[model samples]
Target: MEQRESGGMKILFTGGSSFTGYWFCRQLLEKGHEVIGLLTQKRENYEGIRKERVERLSCEMELIEESPFGSEKMIDLLKKGTFDVLCHHGAYLKDYKSEQFDWLYALETNTKNIKQVIHLAKEQGLGAIILTGSIFEQNEGIGNVPLRAFSPYGLSKGLTFEVFRYYAQLYNIPLGKFVIPNPFGMLEEKRFTFYLISQWKRGNIPAVQTPHYVRDNIPCDLLAGCYGRFVEKVFVQKGPFYRSNPSCFVESQGAFALRLSREVSKRSALSCPVELKEQKSYAEPLVRVNAEPAIFEVQEWSEERFWDDYVAYALEHY
Candidate 1:
């Protein structure tokens, strides 16, 4: 296996067409690492947008169109490729509430894919594998919580983590896990923050059923920087790295909407009236874990600054 040196470690990144994957790859490239992005040929929604971004940003790195879950092909690539790490960011992301074929899709795209990657990593004798996790894996309630994923999407993520953990323990493979909070920045569309902003841009009042739900928002660039630092730390250390916190504070939906409204008004040529009307009750409090200190820490971005930057990016893009 190729070792980490000044030239940078060779890494195979799955889900290169994902929002998180796109930013993560950019960060790795900026840090002088050699990244080989594995992407599928088909394009849809966020994945399609992410794929375009990766193509636009990554000119030097090798972007291959191949299914990472194809065990035979992946094993062959692992054997031939001089890679130090395998970053698993690919998953079948769907709206857990409305999407059909929930469990079956999750099983194939998430659980099965992870198991194959683990076996291939071991066979290749790679240095380490880093996994991008989600806060949704936690149970919804007030205070510190346990791993109890309620929705199908959350359940998929939870199951994937367990699979990775199990293989890491049983085979003694080096692994790093980082659970990400709500990330906003470039190429982001249809998410809550951006969705609200878009509605306000059209001079319309947005309505929500759950205005009290809390979320920890992190900018995509900031999240990428943290992930880069974590990857470097994992390469240098001998033991596995496991961190649940991305060091973000929880903010309520009502607070977020108000702040966003303020930002929209400030940016508009004339006064942009904004109001969030409450409807039928379906609100649920989201529980986020306290951030534990890590080997590499990033300066947190303030909500105001984040909103300003987000609005600027949105205006330029949209």
Candidate 2:
């Protein structure tokens, strides 16, 4: 393993095809660090976007199509490679659709595989392991709250955090967990925000099922930049990076949607009527996580600027 000039870290980044993972890779590259991506076989169109971004930036990055769950292969890579940190952003997010046995199996497999990765990292003497968590782990909008994961996907994330924290403490590894809220930006697939924008563009009133149910939405790019800075702080500054309580960075989802709709209307020259529909019988709880001051210090984008950038990007891409 060759050392980089001026102490630049070599990061082993997982989830290369994911939107957040791609943004994180781009930000790390922008900061003059070496990144090697470990991707799965299920490649999406967004992988092309990530590749294009890497090419456009002229940054040298390696994409290896391998499973992180391959314990022997992963251990070999960590032991032999020049990786200083393992930035794990990979996860299976799809729910098991009421298949209890399948969900339990997936949960067990994910937890076991992640534990193996952590053990490998510790054995290889990596500097730090950054786990990208979700706000669903928290019960309320407060810090240090108990886990209240209702869905299978949320349960998986919450359990993963517990496993990561356990290993970090047991092995005395510097582990950082970033509890992400709803991140909206230039996404390859049309999700809630994109669907709303499409409806608005077609001069249709987008129905808001949960108008009162609030969420802390952060722009994907801003979150990625903050994560990059967090990495730099952890490795370069040699600072303590362990956070038992997940840090939440976000804005009101209803307000975010309104701003997005207005921007879409302006961009498309169409009247985007926002219809606040009656709440459904089965409504998801308001996911409001409290933001830590330490986390906010690294993030630069404000709500207004985020909307502006988001609208422009969507108009160009979507």
Model 2: per-residue Cα lDDT over 1-318, one tens digit each: 234675578898877566777778888987888888766552342345655543433345877655554446666687685468888787765543343524455556555566666677767767777887776654524533243664666667677667777887777777787666666687545677887877766667888777665666656777777788777666554444554322333444556667776766766666777877776644355545646542455545565676677777776765
lDDT of 1 at 144: 41
Q: Which regions in candidate 2 have their CA more than 4 angstroms from the true location?
A: 1-3, 42-60, 96-103, 113-116, 138-147, 236-241, 244-252, 293-308
lDDT of 1 at 248: 49
Candidate 1: tens digits of C-alpha lDDT, residues 1-318: 445658698888877777777888888998899898776653332245665776665576787655555446666677676578778887777666543537567757665545566666677777877877877664422344454654667777777777777877776767888777777777775687667667666767676546666667666877787888888777668486555466444576677667666776787652544455663563233545436432237655355676577778776554
Query: Which residue pairs show backbone clashes in model 2?
Result: 141-288
Each model's RMSD to truth, in Å? 3.4, 3.9
Local distance difference test, each candidate: 0.68, 0.65
